[model samples]
Target chain A: MATEITVGVGLIAIGASLAVGLTAVGTGMAEQAIGAAAVGAMAEKEELFGKGLIMTVIPESLVIFGLVVAILILNLVG
Target chain B: MLRPKQMLKLTIFGPKSYMKQVIEELYDMNAVHIEDYTKKSDDDVFDIGNPLSDNEKHSDTLVKIRSLISNLDIERKNILPRETSFETIEENVTKLHSKVSEVMAKKEYFTRIKEIYTKKEIKKALSSLRLRFDDEFDYTSAVYFIGFVNAEIAKLKEDVEKASKKNMTFDSHYNGVKAIAVFTDHKSKDDVEKVLEDYDFSPIDNPVVKEHFRDLTSAPGQRFVKLDHEVKAVSDKLKRVNDELSELKGENMIFLLSSEKKLTMEVEKGEAPLKFATTKNTFLLRGWVPRNKSKMLKKKVEDVSNSKVKMKFEVPGKHEEVPIEFDHPKMVEPFEAFMELYTLPSYKEIDPTFFMFLTFPIFFGFMLGDVGYGLVTLGLFLFLKMKMPGMKNFLNAFIIASISTIIFGMVFGEYFGFEFFPPAYGEHLVDSLPEHLINALHMHPMESHGALVYPFPHLFSRSHQISDLLSISVLFGIVHILIGLVVGFINIFENHGIVHALEEKGGWIMIMPLIVWLLLEPLGVITGHVYDMLASILPPLPVLGIMFAVGAILTIIGEGVVGVIEVMFLALMSNILSYARLMAVGLASLSLAAVVNDLSGQMIQSMGIIGIIPAAIIMILGHGINIALGILSPFLHSLRLHYVEFFGKFYGGGGKKYKSFGYSPK
Candidate 1:
């Protein structure tokens, strides 16, 4: 029974890690294109810096969602 | 405070003769945003007006003064702006122009002479050939080729002797590359030349040599000495000319800058009529003025034109695109820089500057919550404010953000990631507080050895209270998004009536309660009693389901199936969840500070007296890096939250910023 509980805890930790890690990778993928385009746009019109920043970080919400899900998984299950 | 300043369309017409006067008055008032008149191809009634008389003269003077300023490298910052009358400017500008032109001409001449004589390659060639300027060549009997060659002198002589049947005379000298002079009879000149070509010989131009030293009858060394002396004299003259130009710059820089400014204004006023539509004898000018300032503008124009000009003001039409001028109080003014950095609110849309002013700093402070870090950043921003006055607005926003950091730091009871104070302080002052106050603060006293020590009465310990902080962050997100939706509703209602506003923004607002209920229900299970009370007071789950269904239907009606999906799944869910950054970022900062403190503490304890150096170094460098990231990360995250989430809801920015005529940017 103790071994079963330890295995369960390890699985929960894996689940939590996957939740954050995969989403972070996804966020990075999304931000790669957006950040490149934003930098290109900012190069032409410097006033677009704020808009470029907003555009570049819009995908950051994906990572935040992942983090929240991880926290919830830890709090509710672990 | 929420709306831009109201603008009225203004149209003024006058006799062509009074155009200059009216323009002058308008410029002095600095109230109008002139709309350039584009001629319609179909209309033959009026055409773009010609510039006023003397426009050419003013333009010419302005151009000349600007060139003079650039030529002298007289920076505007170096000279104080002073008032100079037009007559004085006119007289002095011509005089300075002539003086500057004369000096420039002399400098150019000396520079050319210096360039010509600085070619030391010719002197090297002459020295290699062992020749003097006075050395005469018998060009009539023998042809000579004197320059550089890429062959051995002995081989060349043998080859040339064989080619010309021993009829040629050769003299040679070698540096890195060989220089030779070959003298041959006319008959064998072709044969010698052919042989010389095989050896890759290049002949120097003789005319340059003759022209440079035409009057000299001395040897090459004596001639070069004379040339050096002449070059020095020319350089001295060039230096003197430069000194004169600098002195002239010192004397006239202020006058020239003042004149340039005055003439530019004159030229602008003179050319103002070019933007007007005109008939044979009358001109028409159309523009916009602030509603409150319309009367003043009209009066000023009339006074200048002696009532000859006719002015009309009218309220703008619904479809008209008006320029936006933010009307915010002084304290809220700095937040407009954020709007400018993004895009200004359209004239009809609500200005979110005031809202950002309230929320942006709170978000920033929440993420960078530490008393020591806050104080450091606040001092840095305040110091920057004094040093860079041009960026006052941007820095002032950070100042407010850092102040908020301090407030949040107090609530978190964190002093550089420590509880109330660093561990070096031994015991916190909270431990000495009276029992009543400690109880009121909900802090428990613990037995430490024999004495009772009360923890700091912080509302939240960020490092330990992760669950609580996460919940609170989500709660703040919900409230902030709700505010954004309400503002969106108002914005839509103002522009597109109530029904559409309800269908769009109201649907989201209706769904918010359900979202809140769902989020809180989980918390209720964890916290127990508060959730029970909330559950009792709140609508049942089935009712909330009904509300969600209704809200979803409204969203679908407003924005179709895609809109329902976007508003529900993306905007409402992801946007709110994005505020988790507030917790995550602050937690990250706290964790880093804790690590630094731990590492330094361990170093100090383990290494004894010598540990002090590395520990101090680590403490300074680590905290320095943390503080820098603390300022940038929080500031950017807060801005991103507002710009991407909050402003995305209601702001339909792309407003034309109101820039009035004759107003020069400093």
Candidate 2:
């Protein structure tokens, strides 16, 4: 019973970590392209900074969603 | 407050002779946004009018004055603005231009002389060769080379002697790089050059001949000494010229600045007719005037033109794209910078500045909630406001945000990540309150007394009440999104009628109640028993599930299948979940502050008196970094929430901002 409980807890931790870690990686990948394009646009016209910042951070919601999923997973199972 | 100022389409036409007077009147009024007249290929009745007479004269004078201003570095703040007549400006400008230009020409001559003498390498080479300024080389029978060489002087001389087989004189010296001068007869020059080329010789110009100073009958050392004396004289003259220029600037600073202002206006007024459509005998101008100022504009134009002009005003048509001018109160004016940074609200849509003024700071404050950080930022912004008055509007917004941060800080019972009241004080305060009041406020007398304390007399401690904070963040998100949806509904309804509004925005509105219900149920604010009792009359899962279903169906019907996925999950669900950043960011800030405090405390405790240095350094550096991040992160997150989440729902921002004629931004 003890071993089973330990395994269950360990798996839950790994699952939670993966949920946040994979989404963060995905967010970074998405942001890389967006940040480059945003910088290019800003270089041409500096007034595009606000719009560029907005565009670059739009993909950030994916990581936040992943964080929410991780939080829910820990709360519900652990 | 909600919509842009109303504008009327105004057209004025008059005899061509009155064009100048009318334009002058309009410039003084500063109320018109003129529509530039374009001539269509097929239109032969009207063409763009020519600029007023003497336009070139005004333009020339303006350019001269602007150049003078730039050359003198005359800033507006250095000179007081006052009226100056056109005659005075014309006379003074020409006189100043000649005076300044003459001095400038003398300065340029001396600067060139100084440059020639400062070539130290050429001076060194000439001195080493013991060459005289007046030395004559017979071009017919002799040749000389003065340059740097990569090979040893002995080897180069030997190799050249062997190759040329003629008498030659070689002078060489090393100052970082080899400087060598070779003098040979013209017949042997080719053979000597061949050997020098193998040695990688790089030539230097003979400065005496290049500078046309070869007439001086003196050795290189004496010539350099004379040149140095001349350079000193030139430097003194340059200094005197600079002083004279500054003196001239001081005397005419006010005259020049005021003249610039007047001439600029003159030029603008003179060229104004070019924007008008004209026939052989008359000119026509079309523009927008604020509705309330139309009567005044009419009076001014008629008075100035002596009633020679005809004026007409008409309400804008429904399809017309009118320019937008914000009409916000002073308190809400600062937030307009955000709108300007993004895009202006379309003429027909509601302006979001007032709403942003209310909500943006709250979001910012919620994320950076700590009494110490708030007070620090508030003081910082206030200091900045005084130092950089030009950024008043931007600083004012942050000032308000910091105030909100203070309020949230009080609610969270945090002061620099420490509990506002220590445990002993908190216990005493909680005891003094009435028992029922304590119960009502849900006060707990004793708890952790470290950096994060959850005690009575204050609201939930941010660090301890994690779940509660998350729930409240989601609640704020729901309320914020509901407001966005309502605004969207109104916008669509105004433009496309209630049918489309109901189909598009109403679908989202219907789903919000279920979202709220789902959130409340988990927090134990509502239970299944209430819905279970209504289950007999309503359907299973009751009103909430039914509402969700209908909302889903309506969304699908309104936006098609793809939009259903977009509205339900992407827009509605993910956007709300994104607000979780509020809790996450604040928690991160608090945790960092706590870590800094704890680390410093441990350092001081374990290491005794000598540890104070490192501990203080750690505390200062750590809190400094945290505060810097605190300011930037919360501000960006709050802006993102409004721009991406809230504005995405309703705002269709691409309206033309109103720019009036003769209105210069200061």
Candidate 3:
């Protein structure tokens, strides 16, 4: 039973990292596309900088979701 | 069969007589025609159209201004014209243009003559003139700079020579590194030297020569420094030209004396009023008129405006159906009923608006579904949908998805960071926790799953069993489909009477009851011979006599063979499969969650004790992502199962959406 608990906790850590890592990677790639678009928009209209910032952050939810999973796993195992 | 078509169309004839009127009318209709003249300008100068005399005069004018401007100072404001008449403005502009050319020519002529007066050539010239000279200054480097200036001049000269075959020569004064020169009809260096000596006899080191050389060395030194002065001179010249041009404006300004009397003629086909007028031998006109009144309007305009003006019939373009007398209250209700039933339009008609509703919730729930996540998402969507001015509708759909997630969370025995009921609550709380201290909803993770029995205890003991999960999913699917069919019947009955409704609605109603009976009979929840009879209808149909009796009675009295066949086919197959959604969505969620747990566990186990923090992090993040993706899967598949497999049995969606033309498009 102790072994199972320990293994579960260990698994939780691994799962958390995988989710976080993949999320970060996904968000990073998404941000690159969004950021490039934002810069192009900004060059034309400097005032849209704020709107572009919000739009660029939209894809970050993927990473946030991954982070949530990490937290849930941590709670379940630990 | 004899209803006149209401689609808009128009026709016209006679190209020359009607082209101008057509263009003007089209413009009023918001049709854009862009004229492109840049291509002509960028092409060869002659191709753009101008005679040799005009071209030469223009170039000469440019040269004259170029020289004067090069020597003078003028501000930017002076060169530009405020307003002027075309003809007088053209004359003044031409004079200024000539001055610019003259300045450019003088500058080029001097630069070339200066280059030719090299140190070696100057020394040779001096010796031949009996004016002995020695190099008291380093003049070699100046030769290169002089060479560059000469190369530019030579290129300009070559261009002119090729164009006009005019030879260029000038007089030059030199003192080693510096030189001053003037251009004239002189043919060569010898001719220029003779003329310079005749003007004033001087030795090689003459003070005048020294001064002249000094000025020459400094002349090109400030190439860009005198730009402001040159610009000022050009401005002054331009002002003088523009002043002359302005005076001509009084003479050239056109005032229409008979503009009001000039009749605007229009040519059109169909019943639209003429949108434009143009001078023509005979007038023709066309424009949009109401469908009902178009014929009358066309005749009236032709007769009243005089038979001299020809008129034709035209119809307005309607990209959509116009409201007609035939579209009554009942025809519109089906679409609303259809939307209410499935929360989406059927696929037979492709409407992109339905896609937004179906995908919005899945996206919302996926982003937020944990009991903790659900409340937050629900709150956020409600706030935006209700409180925000523009996002109300978009957020409203999101709220629906969030509510679904909350419902799913509750069924799954989930709460804020826990489950529906804690297992320890029954034992520990009853024994240890005081009545005042106990919180009814609070529960430990270990306690939650145990305290509550599975919704379908017959099929599942464990909360996560695939069978139980599937049954729940299909149960939802069945109900969703049944609702869609009920709505479909409402539409059918309204449109074609109960006879039509029976053929469609009877099948779904029959299938639902039989399936409900079978599921309930096995659980022993209902004790009746009806279950036995309904269950047998699936395989043996021992009650074929009963079914035939009902069929014969219903058909003879009312809904015929169609109703009987629908009941048989739909009851026999579709009803049972409609419940497949229960299995599909339930399994989809459980398997995904399990995979997330398993994969995250493996990752942690492989890493040693040093991997503890990283493992925990991985598990949390992985499951979080899985939760989001998990949320979308169930909602979408659930909706899909209802919309397609179940509701599709009765619903055919191709109802036209209402569009108001006079309102602003959203």
TM-score of every model versus the real structure: 0.79, 0.80, 0.38
**lDDT score at residue B22, model 2, on the 0-100 scale:** 88
* Candidate 2 wrongly placed segments (more than 4 Å): A1-7, B42-44, B78-81, B105-237, B420-457, B517-540, B567-570
Candidate 1, residues A1-78: lDDT per residue as tens digits? 123456777777787889899999999999999999999998999988877877787787787777777777776452
Clash pairs, model 1 backbone: none
| TM-score of predicted chain A against the true chain A, for each candidate | 0.87, 0.89, 0.84
Per-residue C-alpha lDDT of model 3 across residues B151-255, encoded as one tens digit per residue: 233444444334332233222333322232222222343443443333222223333234334454465221112123323443454455455444433332221
Correct interface contacts retained, every candidate: 0.57, 0.43, 0.00
Give me the candidate number with maximum DockQ: 1
Task: Output the better candidate (1/3) by DockQ.
Answer: 1
State interface RMSD in Å for all models: 5.7, 5.3, 15.1
- Model 2: residue B607 alpha-carbon error in angstroms: 2.0
Question: Comparing candidate 1 with candidate 2, which one achieves the higher DockQ?
Answer: 1
Runs of candidate 1 exceeding 4 Å displacement: A1-5, B77-83, B97-246, B420-431, B439-457, B522-537, B567-570
